[model samples]
Target chain A: MFLKLNEIGDKIAIAASGGKDSTVLAHIMKLLNERYLNRKIFFHWLLQRYDYGLDLFLLSIDEGISGYRDDSLETVKRNQLEYQLPLKILSYKDLYDWSMDDIVKEIGRKNNCTFCGVFRRQALDRGAVMLGVDQIVTGHNADDIAETVLMNILRGDIARLQRCTFIKTKSEETIPRSKPFKYTYEKEIVMYAYFKKLDYFSTECIYSPNAYRGHARVFLKDLEAIRPSTILDIIHSGEAFETSAESNPTNVTVPGVCNRCGYMSSRDLCKACLLLEGLNRGLPKLGIGNTEKLRKKHLDEKEKSIGEYSSSKRTPGNPFIQNFNDLKLGSDLKKPL
Target chain B: MKINLEFSGGLELLFDGLKQTSVVVEDSSLKNLFKKIESELITQNKELFLKDEKLRPGILVLINESDWELEGQYDYQLKDEDTIVLISTLHGG
Candidate 1:
C-alpha cells in the first residue's frame, strides 16, 4: 500500500474513531508516509467525543463526568504522546449543550438515527475545515461499504445506493471527504491490526443497540459461514455496479439562511431551529406533531373576536373599544409571524 | 386489489400487524397505503409512534425501492405491488 502513497498528497487528515478500523487506518497512513511518502504527508487525527457515558456504564458510577474524568482521555493522551500528531476532540456539548441522556431520549422519541449521523458528519466536516485540510480520510473498509450497499438496496434507498460507489468528494464544500480503505475489508483491517499488535478500543459503544446493522452483519456472517469468499464477492459486485449520476439528486439548497441557526436548509427555519422553538414553547412536539392545532388555535381566537365584534356593533366613537380591537388584531397576527 | 408488500434487503423484522399480510388498494394511492400502515403501526404500537423526534433520524422509508423523501412526500403515488421498506440506520462505525 506504501507503493501507492506517491499518488496521495502531503496534507491529509485521518478520521480516527479510536477503534480498530481507524487505528489501523492511521497506522497504515503513517507507515505509507514514513516508509514511502517520505513522512511528508502531514496528517492530523480528528476524534468525535460521543458522550456515551461508557466509562460510567463500564465502571457503574457517575460522580466525575467532565473532561479530566473521562476514561478515554488516557487513551487519547497516550495516542497523542506516541504519534506526536495533533488531535482534535469534538463533543456534542460544544455543538449543543445537551447531555448524553437528553440526546438518547430525544433520539428514542423518533427512533431515528438521522440526528446523530447528520450532527457527527457536520462536526467532522467543520472540524476538518477549521484544521485547513485538503482531503479527509475515513476508515470505511470494503466490508462497511458492502454492508451499506446491501442496507441501501434492502431499504431501496436509491440515492444512497447510487452515491455509495468509489471515492466521494464534494469540491463545493470547504474540505473534501475520501476513504482510502473504501476498498478494504473490516476483517482485513482487524487482521492487519492484530498482526501489527496495535493498541485500540475493542468495546462497542454501550448505547449502540444497532439492530439493523446487527441483522445485516449476522446475515453476512451466515453467508460467510457457508462461503468465506462471499464478503469479497459482495464488495466486488458493489465495485462492478455502475451508478448512474443522473438518477441521483442532491439536496435542494434553500434561498434564505435559518433565522435562528445559520445552517443551510430548504426552509427559512431548519429542523434544529424548529426544535429549539419547541423547546422554547415548552412543547417539544410542537414541530413534530400535527401543526394544525397551533394554526387552528389562532384561527379560533380570530373567529371569536370577529363574532364578538359583529354581535356587539361597537360605535365608531368609542375610542377605548377601537384601541382594544386594534391590540387584539395585532396580537393575533403576531402569533404565527 | 391484493398487493404484495415486500422488504428487499435482509432486514429481519418481527412485525406484529403484518403477518403474511397483503393489503387491498381500492382507490388509495401508495402514499395513502403508507399512511394506513403508519396509523396501523401507531395503533398496534403506540409507544413507538408517539416518539416522533427519535423516529425521523436514521430511518429511511422507501416506496417501491425509492426514498419517499426524494420521490414525493409521504403522500406519493402507489402502484398495486409497490414494496415499502422501512430501514433503520446503523449506529456503530
Candidate 2:
C-alpha cells in the first residue's frame, strides 16, 4: 500500500506505539527498504521509481498512563535496538503539562479519549518536527481505517469521513503522515508478529473505557465474522464518498494556522489548544463533545487572552508554559505552571 | 488433547501475563477448549475475554497461523500440537 516509499525523504520516522501492528510494520518497512536496495523490488513499477536510501527512526509518545505507556515505551526501545534504529520518546506531561492519569482525575473517563487522541495527534507532529523528520508512518491497518470510517459516519462528521480513508494525511504545518499497512488486515499483522517473534507491548489504558469506539469495533467485528471482506468494503465505500467545495460549500472551512500555537488548524485555535486551555483553566469539559459551545467560548477567550498576552509578551492563554521555549521534554517530566 | 495456546494484544494480561501455554484438554474442539482455558487458565478479567458464552467480538482466533474463518472457526476439530492463537485487535494502536 505504501508503494510510493521512493518519494519519501531520506529521514523518516515510524510512529511506533509498540503494538502488534507497529512492531510488524517497523520490521516490514526495514525488510522492504532492504529488498529495494538489493534489487528485489516487489513490483515492476518499483524497479523504475524506487530509491534505496532511507533512514528510519522509531518515535513514540508516552501518554503517562502508568502501566500502559510506560510498558509500551520499553517495547519501543527494544524494537529500536532490534531494528537498529534511533528512538525518540515524547510525553504528554512535558508537552501539555497533563497526563492521561491526571486528565482522568479532572474529567471523567467518558471524554478522556477525546483529550488523549487530540493531544497525541499534535504531539506526534511536534515530535517529528523536533526530530527534523517531515515524513511519519503509522501502523493504522485496514481494521482501524474501517472502524474510523464507521465512527465518522456514526458521528456525521462528513469532513473526517472523507479524509480518514486517505493513505496519507498532511497539513501545512504538520508532518506528512502515511500508513504503510493501510490495506493490510489486522490478522496478517498479528500473524507476522507472531511468526517473526517480534517483541511488542499490549495493554489497554487503565482508564480508557471508550464506549463509543468499543461499540463500533464490536459491531464491525461481528460484520467481519460473517464476511471478512466487510472491513475492506467499508473502507472502499468511505473512499467512494466525494466531498468537495461544490458539495459542501459552507460546511467546509479552509485550513489555516492556529493563532495560539501556529499549528495547522481549521479554526483559529486547534483542538489541542482548546483542550489544553480547558485543562489548564480547570474547565476540562470545554472541548468535550459537540464543540460549538467551545468554539464560541474560545473566540471570546482568545481575543481577551491575545490582548492580555500582547501586553505581557507571552503565549496567549496557554497555561503549561508560556511558549515552547519555556517547555522541555524527553529528559525530565515538566510540572504544570 | 494437547493444544498450544498463545495470547497477545493485551489479552495475556488477563491470563497472568502468560503468552504461551500448553494445555491438555478433555475435548477436541475449540468451543470446548475455550471453556477449559477460561475456567482454568484465566484468573482475572474473565469478562474481558468472554461475553454470552462466546469469545469477545474484538478478539481474533487463528489456527496454525491461519484465520479461524478458514479453519472452520470455533467448530474446527483439534489435533495434537494444534496452535490456537488468540489476539485482541481492540487495543489502541
Candidate 3:
C-alpha cells in the first residue's frame, strides 16, 4: 500500500475540506513525500523518463456558505501555511455565479443540497483542471462511501450504485479522483488527528440538514456497532451487484457533452447548467425532481412568449433561447444592441 | 473525579460551541457519563449525541486519547483526569 502513493504521480491535488479526514490526509501525504518519496532512487529514468520530487497542492471549494464554509476556509489557509503546500480556493460565485448562500436564499433549504452537490462536483473538476494536477484525492472514508452505496440503492440509482464503490473514479471527461481513505473508518481518522494534534474544522454546513443521508448513515453505523465489518460488507455487496444491460435497460445512459457548459452529461444540458437556468429564471425548483414535466411547461411558456414577439428584434430571457435566435436571425439582431 | 471532556466535529455546537470543558463527576462507567452530558452540558439536540438510551451510533467516543472501542467502550470505568473526546462523524468532511 505504501508503493501506491509513488505510482499516483508527481503532481497531485488534495481536495482539502478543512475537515478531519482531509486534514489528516494532507498531513500523512506530506509526511510520506518528505520521509519516503524524496529519498527514493529512480531506476525507471534510465529508459528516457525523467523523475521529479512529489508536488502537492491544496484545493478547496468555497460554496459561499456564511458560517460554515467561511470558517472552514480559514482552516484550509492555516493548513497551507503549516504544510507548505500551494493552496487554491475556488468559489461557486466565481464558477457558476451562485453561492450556496444565494442558492439557499433563492431555493430555500429543501432542495439546495441538490444544487450544492452537483455544483461542488464540477467545481472540484474545474479546480483540478486549473491546477493542472495529475490526480485529485478526496477525504471520502469508508463510512461515507458505504452511506453513499446505501443511498444509491435506496434511490434505485443503478448507475451511481455501480460507480460509488470505486476507490478511484476516472472517466474520459473528468479528472481522475481517488479516495486514499477508502477503507479507513471515520473513528480512526478522528482519533489519529486528535492524537497528532492536527488542526481541522468540524462544523456542519448551515444549509444542510441532509436528512436522507443522515438516516442511511445512522443505519449503517448501527449495523457497524453490531458487526463492525458491516461497512466493508455493504461496500462489497455494492461492488458485487452486476446489472446486465438487458436487465437494467432504462438506467443506462450514454455519456455526452452538455451544450450549455460543455460538461459531461447524459443530456444536452448538465445538471448544474439546468439548475442554474432555473435559478436564473426565478424558478428554482425546476431542476429538483421530475424535470421533464417542468421542462415541457417551461418550453411551452417560452413558445408562447416568442409568438408574442413578432418583430424578432426582442431577445428571449434565456440564453439557450437567445442562442436559437442568434442562429435563426444571424444578421438581424447583430446590429449592435 | 474530574475528567476532561472534548467535544468536536460539530458536537461543540450542542455544547454552546465549547470544544473542551472539564466536568466533575463521580467515578463511573463511560455509559453513565452520557446522561451527565445530555442533562447538564448539552444544550439542545440530545438526539444528535445520545439515542436509544445509548451513545448515538454516529458519535465516536474516545477515552484517554484511545478509541473507546479499545478500552471496553461504554463499560470502561472512568479515571481521574482522563481525557474523553466525543467526536461526531455526522458532519461533512
Q: Quick one: best TM-score, which candidate? A: 2
Alpha carbon lDDT of each predicted model: 0.50, 0.79, 0.78
Q: CA lDDT of A315 in candidate 1?
A: 37
TM-score for model 1?
0.54
lDDT for predicted candidate 3 compared with the true structure: 0.78
Candidate 2 lDDT, A246-268, residue by residue in tens: 66653467878676666677877
| Real contacts recovered, all predictions | 0.10, 0.60, 0.80
lDDT of 3 at B62: 77
Worst 10 residues of 3 chain A by lDDT: A328-337
Q: List the residue pairs that clash in candidate 3.
A: none
TM-score sort, best first: 2, 3, 1
Tens digits of per-residue lDDT, candidate 3, B1-93, equal: 998998887789898899899988897988888888888998888787887778877677878867788899878998899999888775678
Chain A TM per candidate, in order of listing: 0.66, 0.87, 0.84
**Model 1 alpha-carbon drift over 4 Å, by segment:** A1-10, A37-70, A105-112, A239-337, B1-93
Give TM-scores for every candidate, taking all chains together and pairing residue i with residue i. 0.54, 0.87, 0.86
What's the DockQ for every one of the candidates? 0.05, 0.63, 0.73
lDDT of 3 by residue, A1-337 (tens): 3425335355789999999989999998888666554445645543223233568899999999998899999999999999999988878876666788888888788988999999889877777766778789889998898999999999999877878888887476677888889889887888788778999998777888789988998798778769979999988999898888876764567888666556678886678877877887899887889899987788555645534332354444433222321222112222212
Candidate 3 deviant stretches above 4 angstroms: A1-8, A41-53, A249-252, A299-337
> How close is chain A of candidate 3 to the true chain A, as a TM-score?
0.84
Error of 2 at B55 (Å): 3.3
Q: Candidate 3: DockQ?
A: 0.73
